[model samples]
Structures are given as C-alpha cells and as structure tokens.
Target: MRRLIKLGLGSLLLLALIWVPTSSTEATAQSQVSEIPNVYRGCWFQPEILKYRVRMTATTFTFGGGYYEQKHWQPIKQQTYRLSDQVTAGTFTWSRSTNTQGYHTIKVRGGAYHVKVSQGTLFVKQIRQGHDINGYELTFNQISHAAQVLSGDVH
Candidate 1:
C-alpha cells in the first residue's frame, strides 16, 4: 500500500508539472514586447529624401529602405532582423557623436549596431571594433501620413 501511494503521488506531481507553465516561458513572452517608449514606436524616414527608413514596434526593429548612392536617392529592398537584446532605459555612448547618444538603446545584428530615439528622431549607427563608424550614422524622422500628403510626398 505504501509503494502504491508513492506511485500515485509521483503521477500527480508529474501531472501538476505538465499543467503549470515555467517562469522561463513567461519571461520570453514579456521580453517580446520591446522596452522602447511608445512615443518612439513608428516608421521613420528622412524628410526631403527617402534615403533610409526605420520601423519600430512593440517587439521588433527594422532598418533599411531607400538609400542614397551615385549622387541620387535609390530605392533598396529592406531587410528585417531581430534586436540582439532587450532595449534598456539609459544612455548609450559611442565616441560623442550627437546622433550616437540617446536616452534608451537596443542592439541589433549581433551587436553590430546601436539604435536610439531622441526628440522624435530615430538614430542608427554601425559599430565596429568597439567604436562608431563615421558617415555610417543614419537619422530618420517619424512619418506622418497627413503631413506627407500635405508635403506632396504621398500621391
């Protein structure tokens, strides 16, 4: 009878374990929602020229799009990649460039780039060998549908 009771308790314990979700699952779900502020969530692009674009969501950051080359703006395919880590609240410093500093930041492409939003603009810069690359910095303004239509950006 003692052995039978132990087996029953073991089976009950196994069932309980199967029914309960582990903390890791909860953490992953929570982490999927980005830490970037809501004000920074949107698609941003250069004003006069569509040289580059960046889109931010509750869980993802996408960078790429129309690029300037050969002395003209060219439309390029955008690629989506995951942020290397959760965005944390704090300033990210890199060589004192104005666009390289912000109140919050996230890593991208295996820490190849640092992204930040400040004063309604999104800034992205590529990092190599622990330093920011010059001329590789990108600044984008939030896209406004109404403003774009009024500005003749949208037809």
Candidate 2:
C-alpha cells in the first residue's frame, strides 16, 4: 500500500535526523535527542489519488514509526473561500524580530476540487466528496518525531 511506504519513509527520515555522528560506539551512546538540527524537514502526499497508482515523493529520510489519523470529508454547496486566504501559524521556536517560526507562509489550493485550505492554529485543509463543494471535511496529518529549524538560543 502507498500509505505504508509513505509512513515507512517518514520514519526513516526521522531516525536519520535523530542519528548522531560519532567516532565510535561509545560516542554514539552519548547523543542527546534535542541537538540542533541542520536541515529543513517536511511531509507531503496526495492521498486522495493514491489509488490511481501515481508515484509522488515529498521527502525521504529513512524507513520505519506509528502515526495514524482519522479523516472526514463533507461537501459545501455554495463555496466562497478564496486562494488569497491564509493564516500565520506558530508551531516551532520563534524569533521575536523575524517572526518566521513554524510555517512562514501557507498557500491554499483546491476549494473547487474538494480540497480547501484555510488557516487556524496550523495550515488547515478540507476535503469534500462532490464537485464544487461549498464546504469540506478535514483531518490533520503529522509526521511524528520530527525537528524544526530553531532560531533562538538552543540552550
């Protein structure tokens, strides 16, 4: 199943992120879980069309975790949401001056095709089961054991 593969790759990626570089086994045993990470990490997928047998990859780190989400989709009859709709979120450490923590910019796509992106605490995506649905159901998908690009002093 495609979901299985996606979940596996996401797990590997997280493990590699937590993996510490060491000169020996002893050094490997002394790594901390909250070390400063040095890269941008994200997850993506088009679950709606996975049955079509399309191979799409957003990010790949490794393979292996347990993450499950319950999803729901409802259709709106007369839509009025726009692409310009956006919401600023704060999911990670922040710089009081730059204000770029969490997601700096979230773009919405899909209200016309059953997928509408709105803003709240995080990037919100709604899915529907009809054409030109006015409203939609939504579920949040998150990759577990991930790190963020920290700006403030880590200590």
Which numbered prediction scores highest in lDDT against the true structure?
Answer: 1
lDDT tens string, model 2, 37-128? Answer: 22222332222322111111221121112122222122223222211212123111211121132322212232211122234111322323
The per-prediction tally of clashing pairs is 0, 7
Which residues of candidate 1, in runs, are more than 4 Å off?
A: 1-3, 14-34, 48-50, 67-77, 83-100, 135-137, 146-155
Encode model 1's per-residue lDDT on 98-120: one tens digit a residue: 23245244544344566666677
Best by TM-score: 1
User: For model 1, what is the C-alpha lDDT against the true structure?
Assistant: 0.58
Estimate the TM-score of every prediction: 0.58, 0.17
Determine which window of 10 residues in candidate 2 has minimal summed lDDT.
51-60
